[model samples]
Target: MDALPIAPYIPQHVKELLNVSIKLIRFQYIDYSGILRCRVLTASFCLEQDQNVKFVGTGPAALYASYVEGTDTTPVAAACRLVPDWSSFRVCTYAARHASVMCRIYETLNSFGFRRCPRTCLYKVLEIAEKELRCTFLGGYEIEVVFMDVTKSPPTPFKNVVEWSLMEGLRGRPIEILEQIAESLEAANISVQQLHTEGSQGLFEITTGPLRLMEATDALVYTHETIKTICDKHGLVATCFPKPSAAKGLVGQHLHLSISSLENDPIEARTVDAYIAGILSHLRAICAFTLPSHDSYTRVQDRRGTNGTWVTWGTEFRDVPLRKIESTHWEIRCMDGTANVYLAVAALIAAGIDGIRSGRKLSWGDSQKSPSLMTDSAREELGIKTRLPLSLKEALGAIKTDLTLSSTMSQSLVEKYIKIKTEEAESLEKMSPEERTELGIKYF
Candidate 1:
């Protein structure tokens, strides 16, 4: 029962996790202020849920257990179930508990009458997508986040950031952080395709192997927790916000996705193109969730695509809503680390599936490098309309227009998220940027 403070878990389940791994307590969610965050689990974090459970987030319903004896004081990391050839996972979690329990929960749920997709927004999005396209959708996702040397003895507003240097950005000893991240990701079965430094200061990315809907969601949460811990140990802060800092805060999580059929064939050309169209059509609305923060709009642009401009395909057009990485796959650029990963990715999946089902027109354009690379007149003429919402409230209103999308985004969750965000925006409005700056992660 969800009682005051979630009570202590049933002794049996706690014992089971402890027996398997006792060196650690369960995974708890804490925000930048070191407050225990909430974990919203649709079901229990029972070990048996391995086959039945789908994914977990910071609501506090589930956590990993490890038996390393005296490792209580040690820092822990998160690992995903990535396949091989991506990153080595063992050294990755020198401090992490075994993820076997997580898989067990998933496997057990499947054995029972549970759907591979859980009863959550991400699942609903996947479900709607499959139903619409009348086909299966495989998910291949990757995101980027930035880290800084912010101390936590007592947190402070993040005013300092390392400007990304193409020459020395990740070229120095700092690159070791990327190596550790890759190893930890691999340990959890998550694979890393590559790691890179971004154009912004201290911005970095860790690409992961492809996974289905639920599993992909799990990986995203785990990645954040893992990296955050590591960053903390280094006396730094890892921020996934659309833009954590205004001086040079263009932080975003670019999602690279690939969809396939029940059969092995991929959604190429026509369907894929149409899928892009559907995504673009629904993009402004989707940003209501992706750019969920009041400051989220500040991080978007078409020039570099930070302004959340057009939904056009271009060559590394960071500002474009959707940039074609190749003929088979493309990455959406507007999403930020601050947006709920599950909500944003699920919106994309649903919107694209809608595109496929609607048999909409597929629109493609020159993949420019950044917003500056493309002229406004040319972008408009190409039918690549600009629809990035400037504020969180504006984006939420845009998302509200799509009744069908509301189906994908649970009204309950949206209500809570929007209510909190609206207050935040108003609060930020009351304070000068400097005042808001002193309080770290006000939106997050």
Candidate 2:
């Protein structure tokens, strides 16, 4: 109906280049499982007056249920249109002739629109944050991915280098690919705060600075695509799968978040407290969207050292699911690459908005010790009674019963998401641990 919001501010040079030199446009969106999907068009076709919105078959909406196995489901069995948000356009650093922009799905080229779209869902949550709380959500991600040499029968780690954050860990093609990924990200106007090796073999992390909610999610998708594309060009596979192998440690999509008033001032303490409280209250339910796969639970469970099993928060504590950072932001460590970035972020913000609106008290105290280590009596004393869902099915069950979260995110979308994930979780349950891990690597 209304014009899309103006693109976040970009450098004048980039703006000039995009207006004059961009030749092709890619309309990109992520399915429920965070897989990147795209449709390409010539710059001329995109600029035509009649081509403002492009048609995309509705099959992608059921991507979570049918993408891995070509089965059509009800929620996405029809056709939809992709309406590109010109404001979100960015030059494709990996492809010199192409540029990309994010899109929202619509039921028709001219209509009220499809409300169940993942991007639309996120935008709705952001609007609630802005209108009700008078605060804008800001976020960034620490994305971890593992590189593998797929030439082998079973993809092997790209290299044996396992030194954490060490330059020596990236020696041959890995270093070159990382450098290119960094360069490509910057070229797309996505700031790279840091890029370093992780503790696992062939694993690395890229940290980006915060942007407004939608922009941050867009950047994250592009970041994943850039890394994967570059690795492919180098004849290696880059997977953000939560746990490609038990022996190589876990991969996480750690989210850092903050809030600011409409006037751009930092939010007050009460607001921050309420927001964090909301997240804690709905943490278990929200995991259905954040950690959407059976393998995701395996990576987050106790003994993974990822701070996933407990529902606790603390300042600078790595063993807590929600860690307060720099006294200004919070990091959610339960998520992984399997999550649809849009859905994950939307559910999180929606839950936080509920907290702010309800003025819910922040109950959980700072826990220096891991929940796994705390005695049952000690945990009871601290009021840390809740545990995160240990399986995809359990997480979906929690979501189905969570009134605040389910109501905030529309019941229709939540129900569809649960159905799809339930099927996936049940299917995975029939397999052995090794089989499950292999399937995770293959699909995620």
Candidate 3:
């Protein structure tokens, strides 16, 4: 078994944590399937005097656990260690006497981070952006979830449906649940920019204020966990599945991102241009991570506010996937809650850095109108030369062919990821839309 030392990972404020009556410590990590997995230890166990007593063991396959029912997707027979990043520690507001800390996966006690660890991939890319490119990123997610009363036969919406942003959506029990969620997040120091009803039955959207890349992802995970925990406590289910119902229209976890110089100076115009260009250039391949699930592709239809199929960008345009808000800020409309956010964000930054390094230019013109509304010649004149991969299989294929993007994320990890996802796509392809939707609601 791999051993993770407790001393180095423990925070200086251990006494403060104990004073809060925190009894259980959860070492959490996001698996390849975007599911949050954890191992719990009693707070007393962490105070052991014997050095040999301070370790937690995990199987390597935990990183490759399938979305179907948490089964191992790979046959790797080895132990893995969970090294807690003490910085991510926060009191579990939803669970009394509990705390959570994000972890980094290691193959052995002495080894560096595991190659296939999604968190590790994100850290490496972030470091490259800061140290090499002299840039740092800030981002936040617009989370959309559909609440259901699972106790009902076939399940039904937990609240009476209302129009988008209507105050009635937050009335009664719904408001109570959201208030508790907001309070929990605030206790953890995660800012809530806004919370409102979405344009779908039983769907609600929570937008968080921007933070540094890693912090933003961790907050998103925590926020998701908080929402589910609160809903479960009230006998409801919250599913982040995009296109949860084929007829209910699409809902996604859209990511808004911005970049600034590492020293906090104004970002260079060329750097911004190349970064956006880089993302647009590699948009097709990046979809493998952003719009990951089989159901995710169903949300990519044209003229449905799902972000159009075209590989381009426009200023505040909902039809295009990449919507530029300013020279430094852009909103990526393709991502969903099914994505492993760390890996998704890493892929985006890496691709953008690749463009910055290569000094690529943003050649595509700003699409003022949806391409679907434009004539063929009109789109051609605007340089909308490519389209997003239309299916999970096609997206996987795109990632495989984009050697630069794959190599940057580590070729071995990419191959393993592709293998796991290829299996998922094949398995999902055999099922009907209803079955797929049911499976999605069950897990995601």
Candidate 4:
């Protein structure tokens, strides 16, 4: 186990406490399908080893290609190594007798970074942002999940009232589940800024405080796992599926972002404007990563207020795709729970960096009316030229043609991502809507 560069920042007292308290260490990573996977080793194993690196088969990466369903010829079919990032080390509050940490994947013999690794991809983009743009990105995710009654034949929403932030909605099991989730997240050092019921029955949202790019996304992954684990222990099913049903409203994983200089000052207006312009310019292509599933498109429709269909932005308008919260921050609404948070954030950073470099200007003004409600002539007058891609196939096609976004991601990763998602889209085309929803809940 190779020690992380963050070891220097760990206080000696905290280090000693961890060394004494932890019995097992879990090295976790998110797969291409956005599922959290882990490999566990005894604490003594890490303490005894000079370098904390652990070797594991790369079969997990092949999971996106359905390697388990059939044969896998992907590069990830070989052996690889997990290099622990000590900065991400967290004491597991949900599970006793173990601690968890995230790892960067590297090829065993060649010592090359795995191209398809989401964490590494994010780090590369962040590095470019800091080095070239001279800025630091801070972000947090607003996670929305539904609690289901598993005892029913088909799981149903746990609450009957379909109200937003209503106390009546949280009267029973929902409140207890949410309280436990908040406690568990706080215990793991992941702060929950707010937790409340959403518009959909049994749907709740958790808002977390901001952190640097990598830490924010990594914390979200841990947060989701904690919610699901605790919910299961209480005999309820917690799902972040974007649209659990057509009758119910949509659920989203909205990303809130802000940028600041190395000196910790808020970015200038010109720089901030260009950064947003860049994102809006490449949003359709970026959607290939942020909204990865066929069902994801189902949630990103017009008039939903959850996510808009057009590529426009506004000041605190929920109907627009990008809602400007403050001079320094904006909320990206197109993303859903199914997205791989690391890849999604990386794509946004890549787009923003390009925008900054190119000095892009905002081509359109803010619109208070939802694009879906606006007349064609109104949209034309505002310079809103295109609507967002309506399907997974269309979104993938947009990425294929997007030179700017394609250049930002590694060619190998983009190719593999398209291949895996294309296959998924094709497969979904043959399934019934109910079948598709069931499968999405199981994996996403």
Top model number, TM-score? 3
Clashes counted in candidate 4 amount to 5
For every model shown, the clashing-pair count is 62, 0, 0, 5
Model 4 segments beyond 4 Å from truth?
Answer: 1-19, 49-57, 60-77, 108-112
lDDT of 4 by residue, 1-444 (tens): 222232223335435655798788788887666667778877666654423433544544433544123224446435565666667888889988777878776654443356666777888888888887898988888999988786875667775577888888888877888899999998887879998888887889999999887888889988988988899899888888877765566878999998888765767899988999899999898999898887888777777787678889888899878998898889999998888778888889889888999999988788888977888899888768778888989999988888777678666677767888787778777778877767766665
lDDT score, candidate 4, position 112: 36
Between candidates 1 and 3, the TM-score winner: 3
Q: Residue 441 in model 1: shift from native, Å?
A: 4.0
Candidate 3 stretches greater than 4 Å from native: 1-7, 49-54, 69-75, 109-113
Query: What TM-score should be assigned to candidate 1?
Result: 0.71
lDDT per residue (tens digit) for residues 1-444 in model 1: 011111222245544544565334333231211122332222234333334432332211121221111212233332222111111112226354432222211212112211111224566667666655555554545566666555542333233234543546776544777787778778767778877766666777677777775666567666776778776677667766554555454666667676666556665578777877888788878886677655567766645535345556665555567767776567777776656566677677777777777788966567555544557776665666665677777776777677655555555445544554555556556666545444434324
Tell me which residue pairs clash in candidate 3: none
Relative to the true structure, how large is the alpha-carbon lDDT of every model?
A: 0.55, 0.77, 0.83, 0.78
The local lDDT score (0 to 100) that residue 399 gets in candidate 4 is 85
- Per-residue lDDT over 5-30 for candidate 2, one digit per residue giving the tens place of the 0 to 100 score: 23323345544555688777787877
Model 2: lowest-lDDT 10 consecutive positions: 1-10
